[model samples]
Target chain A: MSKHRLLAMFKGFDDSLPVLRDIKAGGCAGVSIDDVDYLSPIEHPDIDEILERKVNVQKFTFTGAVFGVTFGFFFLASAQASFLVQPQGGKAVVPFPTNFVLMYEMLIFFGIWTTVFSFLFLAGLLRKRGTLYSEKLTVDQCGIMLEVDEHKLKSVKEYFKKQKSIEIREEAVT
Target chain B: MEIKDKIIDENLGWQRINEDVIRSMDAPGKYYWITFAVCIAMVLCAVAAEIYQYRMGMGTVGLNNPHMWDMYIATFVFWIGMSHAGTLLSAILHIIHAQWRKPIYRFAEAMTTFSLMTAGFFPMIHLGRVWNLYWVLPYVSDRGIWPNFRSPLVWDAFAISTYLSASALFLVIGMIPDMAILRDHAKGWRRKAYGILALGWRGDDRQWRVFRKTYMLMACFLIPLAVSVHSIVSSDFAMSIMPGWHVTTFPPYFVAGALYSGCAAIMTLFIILRYFFRMEEYMTLNIMEKTCKLTFAIAMVWSYLNIIEFASTWYGHNTYDKELLINKANGPYAHIFWLMLFCGSVAPFALAFQKLRRHMPTMFAVSLILQLGMFVERWMIVAPTLSMAHNPHQWDVLYGSIIEWAIVFGSFGWFSLLFLVFVKLFPSVSMYEVKELTFHLKHEMEEEKEAAATSSKSKAGAVGKPGLEGA
Candidate 1:
């Protein structure tokens, strides 16, 4: 046997907490807190308390924005100067106002795309179809997916059962 | 107390919200078919008109030298202005955390992207040579020439593409959660379709966290981007030395006008969606009143800005500006100008009446009037200025020919076509957000009841005992 993958589903927000705390407290032998994942229909800020690292998407957003502004300005300056060899209506070769407008748009344009892609990546979306799930999870139920060793599967299942989980699913890999 | 009614039906459970919203995506009714068929016919007519115009050149649509920026540009601005409805309800109201917007924002966001798709066509249509349109792009060419980025036309190209891209992204990204809900519930080919669009969303705590952040960040970007876009559109006229078009207040005026038209459009769609989908629980009368209030406020802002533009023209004493202003009031466009002023400025006062706001049919008529007013305002902006420009020799009065009018109506058809297809394919109301709103309002209502019960108990005890330590 390789490892036991299990999901515990609960009907209420607070109902998921005790099991989450059990894994976080290291009370569950052969189970790692890092392997536990939470599934919810809505945002639960309390879920962040158990995770070691908070999701940091704004960094990716800012980096993309900075890059967009830098690239946008330079491209406008260089492109206008190198090509428009003739005088432009006796005005500056590259005007700042128009260029600035495009640059600001680029900042948002780049920032939005980067945030979306990074969210897709960090959230582990578009991964191989998840093995353990319930239709109820996306509706009223909350799901917690975790990996456990075969030796500890029975005990963890019992622990989840004691909390009166609405449902429990498992995929054991050999 | 009726005014304080919950925005969505708090009595609804999570599963009910899902079922109701998903049911809206089921087979549409007879009215939908009739309207959709009309839209398809309009689009077909427009396509024929465009083909004729393309073959005969822009002149066939009645474009003389003076009326070059005719109905196409004004309709382009109209569609662009209509796109702002989604931004107003989705982006601006999102940042403010207006829960009432939850049920309606999806359709508004869809309108934003689809109207943009429609608006993008006008510039291409207005081009004398539509095939040679890529020359406006800043790409490297065989001739070693580049587009003049200094032109406000160029600014428009950039602003529109960016606005379109971001808004489209915003619309799709916001739909992911709801798509996942549909994905779980749908079957057969529908499942596969929604599954692909759902992007493997599991609605995990982490995904929701990142989704919320990304949604907010995008909303933050969209508001200013929307403002900047209309401002740039204003510059297409303002940058020109045209007497009536060069007002400094044009940007704010345009933005205000865009929001006013956008809000009115939202009301029209809101009533339609509510009636058709039986989404009365979500699109409640109280919420409609709130939307009416917001629209009334923006209409006032637009009216003030209109006055400011006129007052500036009167005081500045620019001979050309004053003469053009007088001509607009007394010239060929005078009827349209006064209609715009009356419809946009005066008619919205109906919203201030509670009975009128609560009456759906009255509000619907008012919304249509506001749209007509905004359309006239754009026509007045473009037509009168060009007709009475600095050089009188280039002056020509243009009432759009049949071809131009046909194309304008067709754009509306195209937008409706997209919107009709979207509602059929996707849930017009956001399911998860409505569930969340229900959750919040339920808790608040429960807390209020509990508070009321506790107060009554305390008062009863005090009446019997004359005093109590805790009381």
Candidate 2:
């Protein structure tokens, strides 16, 4: 089946939101919007509704932190316990208070690494580049890319037109 | 015009901000090369000094038995303390949603990362056999020898490394969106460099949502981590059984002093960047004024702690503590002590006046003085306490060698060099956050105007009614 993708650009968030909503409603009428993605120079409040889609990045962060704490404790304790304990000044081999410091540091270190890993995973960063990208999206312009049926192309273009899209481009997907 | 409206006018739009920031990276002027060359030269000099010290041993650098922790450790503390204000300011201000932080937080966070890098060097240099530095790492080895987790030095390693990693991550993550922006605008090798660094950021809502969440998580982690890192550094001295070093108030005292010095360093760099980058509109007087005010407040906190330290020492009636406190004021290092007081405590008072805060040259001079005072303050904290320890027989007055001074100067050049490279590469001012602030201000102004228009129309309608006008 052939697909039509419509890309619209706007000057700012305020200019873009109404157009985005109109396109969503218009897609519901006929084209059945397959996917919608926004590209902008900066984050916007209007983007929140789209971003609220469930993401599991924070779960990995929590798991990494817990592992960090447990591993930090075990590493510090085992190193001290297994070593040739000189028993300095009658101090315990694996002191708790001092070891807590290392534990705290490890928690943060592992937590941060895991967070970055999760970010990479969930955000699909460092992946094979996608074709639908515009350099202007990084500057003053905001872009909305929509996937729809080829048969509904005329109506979708008219829908974006009614919303007064600053610019539009249509591409055919195989 | 209202202050907010004026700020909007000065900053303009996303396009203008991008142009202003990216222009700095476009070409290397003669001044840029000159500054870069000077930093390289300073770094080379420091490398030579380190080589000399390595060859001759620890004795070559004014480190006697009593003053073993002289300039290197002092400078380490200073840098560590200097690292504090950036993360503290950036994280805390961000958490609180301070709009002014939008313009300065990028460099401030960069300062935290680079200063920590410089700080990491001192412990390595202070080691007798720097090659054996890996022994500090916690791992099971064939020899079964492990680092004592209980040692504050080990804690120092952990704290500094953790702080460095987190700050560096924070700095890099913060730069990603900006890097994506650079990737779009750049050409040739620069474009490839930014593209790789940007990690295919398309500024999609999903990527941004995750990025913001991760950034916020890091900020939350950074604040407590930053505070704890310095507190751990303080424990390096305070955990010692030494008289002056064993104060109960050391943690808060050290934290306050770190913030004080760090804020001063920020002001010093803020003005320099503003002047050099021609970021007058973004790095406006309003931000500097707020910075000065914060510095003054921190100075006051540090001073109050300083007084409490003295008072507690005197009142506790421990001969060694009292003697050390007295010696700090009037003994061998008296000049250094008083200089610290003058610079750290007294000079910040000038900032309390709005006029001084607004004047760039005066504020810069004051910041420099405050940093100098802070540098001396670190030295004072270490040297005097160790020199005038309980054993008078071991007491000796020692000065930092020329080699030590060279290394100290080198650290400054190293930090500046990194920062200069950063400015040349990335947007030193956060392009997106600044644009966000401008947008909010513009929106607010429109709202206010609309409200005024509606209110005025209602007033006009009321005035048209005879009973209302008479009443």
Candidate 3:
């Protein structure tokens, strides 16, 4: 039978671990197997069964590739226009040695353009809601969201009931 | 949290400059006025000389067939060399992660733009028929006069233009935020002037985003421009069949020499600005020491290149190249060449010691000497080669006439005058970046302080607080 809420008794031993374990074992089925919930000893081996996921956001890498492309295109275009048109002093049109100068210039120009622009774009800046990041996150905090349905709400609440120290609160992504 | 705040903190090393700038502007003492007057007067003299050159034609300058380049081309090279200061300070320093570069980047960029403008003048004036200067472009003509792309001269024109535009744009982009600050602080017509230049900047994230992106772009653009500009300049000499000018390594050698001299020039300016503007607090000994190290390192590279160049000349066993190289060390221009070696190499080598690098007076003196040595090097490069041209029968030794000397002197005056005027008009150090860096440094310090406090209060406080969550 599905249970609504289970209020297991806990004291000392930093209550969070047993509460977390209950949630993990309970499997959001709204049922608790043990009847008389009591405080577990600090050295209890059952706590080892609890699992946690590790996650982190990584900084975006700047490639400067687009910058290179823009530069290459510009230089190629400018080279085709200037040196590639008429052969100079009986030399072949688009003299490879000389046109390399234009290539050098374009690479510089485009590389810079890409590096700067990409940094801005990747930083999530200049958008409508830019600069609106939660200031509190700069200090100490962590937010872990657990999805719950109405059918399992009782079980989760009961599990959290044992974790009185955790300061659980309802939240929506809105 | 924000990069801007990170850059604006108190110990971030900009408080002294901020205070000194305020003092200089408000006080305007006797020496300030005197310096202003002298700068203005010199600027006027340069203007007069330009007008005179225009009226009297290129004949007024001492340009002959064999030594056609004369002072103008030498001055062009000199100014171009000077322009390297900005790119080295701003772009290269940024790339290499030199923090001291923050305060000096703007002025360095200004140096690039203005020196380029000055350098551009020489080519026009040297052409004599300044109006027909457009004929150098690749255009269809009845005479079928196409610019010789093989000629380094044409390449120089393109390289200089591209570099000048890129540099100017970079400078303007970097200055926008600071211009906004200036606008806020200014009154009357000055406010309006700054307002226009500020480009409606607010400290919004969008502007900052674009600004940062553009700045990074500029840095990326500038490094290659820096290398290419000097390489093309060297090409002007190398493409020639002249003995000393016909080396394959001239491109990189010239680039190194340009950067060495450029860094020294920037150091000299930094020293002058520090004392004159009472900016010692902002431009600290730390910055001086770091820049001196850079200067010293580049100096060493230059020394190595110098040896390599000479060694190649000897190894090649080309009679003409060998003779010219020996003559550089022991010929008619031997004294100046030796002096160049002593100042450019010997003086800077002493800076290898940490103590010597930190000594302000010694550092300044060395920088000045290096600049002087570089000038002599440029003169030696141009003059001695022409004097020892192929035809011994036509071996007319080149000497600077009074007119040539006047023009050279006038160009120096012009450059200084423009710099002085720029100092008066704009904030010599960037206020926005300084503020942003200062703010960030302070915020980080506060975070550290808070962390320490919390740690002491609770043994497990840090773990519970979730450091770097989703970082």
Candidate 4:
């Protein structure tokens, strides 16, 4: 089994800020932002620095594009070179301009595909449900999800209460 | 009113935007059923036409000699061009942070993907043996003969497939948050479907941060990809050394025309979605005005390029090019050439008038006219070039047989079919983005109200005691 998770809901983004802040200052039992998950009706980019830091996914896009270019160059060049039995007119066996076009397309193709895959992986999507969910969190409410040890569940519930969270769901993941 | 005030009506809250868009996804009513039936009937007609054409071969479509590329290729080009507007709105405007594109961008992006799907059909329809389509793909075969990468047609294969993959990913990625909303509110099978599609999106900070970055990166790749896609499409004509088809200016000209036609399509769909979905608050007159202004600008650019091509051909004293241009004006296709000019160049002047542009009915009519003009322009490009391609012995005035006509008209039905199904299955508007727009607009409104209150208080205070009352 996994750890116990606390799901706290507030009316709006602003209402959820202080609890996120207060909990950060007070700290949990070896819990940090990595163990914390947020749910909301909409995007809230503003969060206490201690609670969450923006994740980077651009490196995957760059690596994907580089790989695409290298693969495209090798694949297209070798195909052209293999067919040197009958050269078409005076044209070079492997022309740069023609191969470059496909290479450019490949870069964008791989760049977007890699970016999307990395985003899905890093964001913890397409997996078994790990956090307790509430429909209202998607509708009009803001949610803060924090994971902690089993013994510390009561004190975290108190933290949610201190901030006047409208609804809270406590669940143990296995 | 300033467009800032009009982006989202003050009366709308986040919940209203969510519920209203979700309500739009409810089993569509009688009119939707009627339109859907009509689209199906048209597609059936097209399917029957394709079957007949397949059995009887290319002769049925009047594809002979130099006239091998006719209505199918032209319509393919037209649909491919049509896909550009979505990229303009969804990717370019997104990168630039054009907030006005928010409400209308979802449908426009959907248009990009659907039009590309529709456009992709033409090459297959044009092919004599459709089953050999895999010959275009690079794979290990015992024969060892690869597709000619030297050909622009092969470049097209690469560009279109990459374009299709990138735009489809962009559309689905952008829809994840909205899908999550639907998953929560949805019931039964729909809930499960959306649950899988949403990929367990909780709008967590990590998900959002990564989503924002991923979306922006795709947008960057998409803009150049869009330009390259159309430019490569133009190369199918421009790379050919046949008189009028050989113009150096063809790439930019085609790009301009693509944007022009796409913006018009967006206008037509914007009105339909607004009226059908009852999305007045979200779609808004101001966005329509901005769209009209953009379309008009692109139309003018297209017109200018048309003139430049004519002038360069005339001034360069290339007898072949000049004669084709003249024959286009005076030959059997003269009526179409002039109508293309009138619809593509002249009719767009109506958009310059603010009164006509903002009124939905007039804009709808104008958008349809522009589409007609763009369609005919494609016809003009293919027919005139073939008829006047340098060799007098080979010249022939080709008229499309009924099979060709059915396939051409059927494409519109095919597109409408995909779109109708998509609108019901998906939220045509972005829910979370609208919430963000409403959030910003609310703050801007509050600031404006506070400023107004302060100004009024100062005026009232001055009126009771000071001499400069009304000032």
Best by lDDT: 4
Give the per-residue lDDT digits (tens) of candidate 2, residues B1-471: 577425435349688888898986767889989999999999999999999999999889877778779899999999999999998889999888888898999999999999998998998898857987788877655687777777888898888888999999988988888899899888999999999999989887778878878888888888889989999999999999898899899999989989999999999989998998889888988889999999999999999999999999999999999989989899989999999999988899999998889999999999999999999999999988778898899998876889999999999999999998988888889988887888888787789899999999998999889998678
Kept native contacts, as fractions per model, are 0.71, 0.72, 0.14, 0.80
lDDT assessment of candidate 1 = 0.87
| Each prediction's RMSD to truth | 2.2, 2.0, 12.7, 3.0
What does candidate 3's lDDT look like per residue over B1-471, in tens digits? 543323223564333434455454554568767877776676566667667777876666656657777767777887898898787568877777555687677777888888888788778767877888887654544565466665788778767877887787778767766665566566898889987886555443234444554565577668878888998999889889998888888888777778778888788888888888877655767677777888888888888878888999999999998988888889888888899899888988877888887677888888889988887778877887888877766566666765566566767766777787788788778765555445445655788889988878786654567654444
Better of 2 and 3 by lDDT: 2
Candidates 1 and 4: which is better by lDDT?
A: 4
Model 1 C-alpha lDDT per residue in residues B175-277, reported as the tens digit of each score? 9988899999999999999899999998877788888888898898899899988999999999999889999999999999999898999999999889988
Candidate 2 DockQ vs. native: 0.74
After the best TM-score superposition of candidate 3, give how far the Cα of residue B92 lies from its true spot, in angstroms: 2.2
lDDT tens per residue, model 3, A1-174: 332222233333344444555555874464442321222211122333343221111111124444454555554455445555454467666466765675566555545555444544543333443121221111111112244555666556665564563334443322
Q: Which TM-score does chain B of candidate 1 obtain?
A: 0.96
- Given candidate 3, what's the lDDT at residue B348? 88
1 or 4, greater by TM-score: 1
Model 4: docking quality category: medium
By TM-score, the candidates rank as 2, 1, 4, 3
Stretches of candidate 2 off by over 4 Å are A24-28, A31-34, A50-52, B4-11, B466-471
Winner on TM-score (2 vs 3): 2
Scored by TM against the true chain B, the candidates give 0.96, 0.97, 0.88, 0.95
Interface RMSDs of all predictions? 1.3, 1.2, 15.6, 1.2
> For candidate 3, what is the interface RMSD?
15.6
